[model samples]
Target: MESVKAQSYDVHIDELAQAALNQHIAKNDYSKTFVLVDTNTKKYCLPAFEKKFEEPIDSIFEIEPGEENKNIQTCLQVWEQLSNFDGDRKSLLINLGGGVLTDLGGFVASTFKRGIDFINIPTTLLSMVDASIGGKTGVDLGSLKNQIGVINQPQMVLIFPEFLKTLDPRQIKSGYAEMLKHGLIKDKEYWDDLRRENIFEVASSIQKSIAIKNDVVMQDPTEKGLRKILNFGHTLGHAIESYCLENYDKKTLLHGEAIAIGMIMEGFLSHKLTGLSKLCLNEIKETFLQHFEKVDFDTNDMDAILKLLKYDKKNSHGNINFVLLQSIGVALTDIKVPENLFEEAFSYYKE
Candidate 1:
C-alpha cells in the first residue's frame, strides 16, 4: 500500500490507470462506474486513457467542452443520462477533463442520489493546480461566476502530466496565473523561481505548485485564514472576468488572463494603501504584460468594472474589500478602498 498524502481526500500523482482503479475499488466495491469527459477530452485523450482501465467502464458521458457549457442545464442533462443508466449512490464518477468538466461532474456526483463518489483525473494544467484539488464544486449562474455551488471533496485525485501534451498555449498561460498567485501570497521563494523559469518548462515544476496549494488548502480546507491567500489576485480579477464575460461580444478572457490584469490593478492598490515599494509594483506589471495581452478600457467601461467589483464575494457589510499587498511577499485582506480610489487605480493603467 502506498502512503497517500492527506492534504486532500487522497491524492495519487503520476499513477497509472490500473493502480488508480485498484485503489478506488479497494475503497468502495461499487456495482457500476461512470467515466465522464467533455467533447475535447473524449476526442483527444480518452482512447489512451481507456487502455489503462482493466475493468470495462459501465458508461461514458461526454459533454461539449467550454466555460459556456458549465451550468445547471448541463447538470440536468447529465442527470437525465445517469438516470437512464440507473446511476445510484453505489455508482462512481470519473471526471476526465479540465476545470469545467471536473466542476460540473463533481456537482453532479455530489447532488445525485444525495451524494455519490467521484474521482478527478484532471487533464489541464489549470484544473490540476487549482480546481481538481479543492473540494469546492459548483456551476456558474447567469453573469455571476460560480454563483451556485457546494463544497464536496472527491474520493481521490489522479494527476498524469502526459495529458497536457495536447493543451493549447492559451490554456497553459491561463493555468500559470494561478500558480503565480500561489507564490505571490504564500512563498516568496516560489515566486522568484516562477519568474526566472521559462513558461514552457512548467511541467517540471507541477509537483511544487501542487504541494503549495495542497498545504494551503489543508491549513484551512474550509477557506478561512491562510486560504484567503489564494484569492491574492482574484478579488479584482474575478470582477474583470465577469465584466468581459457579460459585455463583450468577442473572445471572453480566460481565468488566468483576467487575473493577470487583476494582479496588476491590485498591485497598484497595494502601493496606495500598504506601502508596497514602487519598484516591486512595476516588476509585477512588467512580468504579466510581457506574457498577456492588455485590454484597453475607456472611463465608462472602467466605471462599469468598478460597479461589478461591489458584488465580489469577499465584500462584507456593503463595503468593497480587497486583498492588497504590504510588500512583495506579504498580503493584507479586508482592506476597504473608497469609491474615489477606484478611478485612481484604473487611471494608473492608462497609457
Candidate 2:
C-alpha cells in the first residue's frame, strides 16, 4: 500500500490509495468532475469507484469495451459529452477501467479545453502495473496500436488491487505478461520470482512492476533515451496485435498476449543481435511457452506483420528500432534490425 512518486504524479496502492484520492479531491478546486469507463468497467467497477469517491461527480461517460473501441471516435464521443456537460479547464476526469478506457480517457482529457486535470484508477492488472502509471496517453490509429497520443501526466494514479477481482483468467494472464516484462527488462530476481507463482495469486506483487516502470519513466519522460528500453517486446508485439485486429480471420490478441509473442521474438533478436547467451535465450523462450500458447503465424501472417513494422513509433530514418536484451534484466535500445533476420526471429519463436 506504499505510494511511488513519478515525474509529476504519485501512484498510491490499495486501501491507502483511496485516502490519497480523497485528499487530492479535497484539495483541488475542480469545476466539474467526470468519470469515464467502458461497458465492462461500468458494470463491474463503477460501484466500488463511487463508494470510495466521496465527492459529487458531474457526469459518467461509457464507451464500448475492447481494443477496437480505443480510437479517435471514442475520444470524440467523450469530448462531446464533456462539452455538453460544460466541462472546463478546471474540470477533473477520473479514468476507471483497463488500459483501453484509461488511454482514451487520458487522451480526451489532455486535449479537451487545451487539457484538464485527470487521474487514473486502473481497474485491470495490465493498467495497474504498466499502462496507468506511464504518462503515455494515446489511442490507436486504425488497426495500428497507440499510433496517436501524447506524454501527458495525470494528476495522480490510484491502484486498488481489489478491482482486479473483476477480471477473467485470460485478462489476468494478459496483465501478468507485462509484469513478467518488467522483471525481464530491469529485475532478474523479479522475473524468476514471478515465474514460480500462480499468475492469479500475485496481485500484491504488482507494486514492484509499477515501481520498475516508474523509475524508467522518471529518467526518460519523453522516451529520448532510457525510456525506449521499456518497449522491449512492444515493437513487433504491437504489429502482431494490429495485424490480428484487422484480420477478421484471426482472433484479436490482448495487449499482453501479443507482447508475450513479441517478447519471445525479440528475445530471439537479442540472442542473434545483442549477444544474449544460448542458455539465457532458451530460458526466456521456455518461460513464456510455459505460460502462453504459441500463436500460429504462417507465411501470410508473417509477411503482413513484417509490413506493419514500418509504422512502429520507434522507427527513424527508415530503420525499425528495437530494444534488445544484453542479458536478462539488462536492455539495449534503438538497435536497427535487418529485414532478412525478421523471418528468422519468427522461426526462433516457433522453435
Candidate 3:
C-alpha cells in the first residue's frame, strides 16, 4: 500500500491498505480489535476488508446505513455492543465504511473509555478525501449534520480506490463534489483539470485532493483559524441537509448532494460579496449542475433553510458567517453575509 504522510495521520492508499494495517496491528499489540461497519458496507465492503486484514477481529458491529441513522440512539447501541462484548480501553477499533460509519465509529471510539486507538478504512470517495482525514469524529444531532462529536485523530487512515467500485455512479459523483471543492479552494489548475478530465479515471487526483486538505488541516487542527476555510459551502449545505431530513415532503439530499447545491448558492454569494468573477461563478454552477441532479425547493423551504443557518456551528455573535471565495482558487473565511443576499443567492441558483 502506498502511503501519504499527513500532519495528523498517515493515509495508506492501496488495495485496502492491507500491509499498513497488518504492520500497525502487529506493532500496537492491543488487547482486542473490533471492526465497525454499516449494513451497506458489510454487504459490499467487509469481505474485502476481512480478506486484507487476514487476522480475526474479536467482533463485528454493524449498524444501519443512511444519514438519518447517525444519531445518539445509534451511538448508544454501539456502546452497548462494545460493553456486552467486553471491549476495554486497550481495544482497537477498525472503522470500515463510508462517512457515516467512520464518523459514528470514530466518535464511539474517541469517547469509549475516554479514547481508545482507532484506525479508519474509508470505503467511499467522500470518506477517502474528506471524512477519513481531519480527525473530526462526530455524529448528527437530530436533523443537523455532525452536531455532536469530538476532535480526535485516528491512529491511521487507509484509502483504497478499489472500494469505490462498489458504489453506484451517483454515489461516486456525490463524492466528486468534495474533490471539486478542494480544487476550487486551493488550486486553479486542479479545478480546470477536474472540469476537463474524468475524475474516476485519475488516482493522483484523489491523492492531490487529500493532500490539499491535509495541508490546510496541518496549519490549523482546531478549526480556530485557517481551518474554517474547509467549511466552505458546508454552512448552507448542512442547513439544507437538516431541513430536507426534517421535512417529510422534501427529498433527503445526500451529504455531497446537499453540499453541491450549497456550493452553487455559495458561489453566487461569492460573486456578490467577495469579488469572485462572474465567469468563474458560472463555471462552478455549470460544472456542478452537470454532475448533480436538481433538487426542488419552494420559497418556504428556502426560508426555513436560511433560518436554520443561525444555528450553524460556525456562527458567532448571532451572525451567520460564511466562507466565500475571493476567486476560483482562493477562499476567504469568516465573512458575515447579509440576510437579503440569501434570496439573491437562491435566485442565482434557480437561474
C-alpha root-mean-square deviation, each candidate: 2.0, 0.9, 1.2
Model 1, span 1-351: residue lDDT tens: 232364547666676535866766777788789999988999888897888766679999989887788899999988988889989889999999998899999999999989999988889988988886768788888767787789999988887778888798898888888888777777788888998888877876677777777887887888767677778778778888888888855358988998998888888888988888899889888888888987887877787778887787767688887788888777787778767777777777654
* Runs in model 2 lying further than 4 Å from the true structure: none
**For candidate 2, lDDT tens digit of each residue in 206-264?**
88998999999888888899988889999999999999999999998899999999999
Q: List the residue pairs that clash in candidate 1.
A: none
Per-model CA lDDT versus the true structure: 0.82, 0.91, 0.88
List the candidate numbers ranked by lDDT, top first.
2, 3, 1
Which is better, 1 or 3, measured by TM-score? 3
Q: Top model by lDDT, which number?
A: 2
Error of 2 at 138 (Å): 0.9
- What 10-residue stretch in candidate 2 is worst by lDDT? 311-320
Report the number of the highest-TM-score candidate: 2
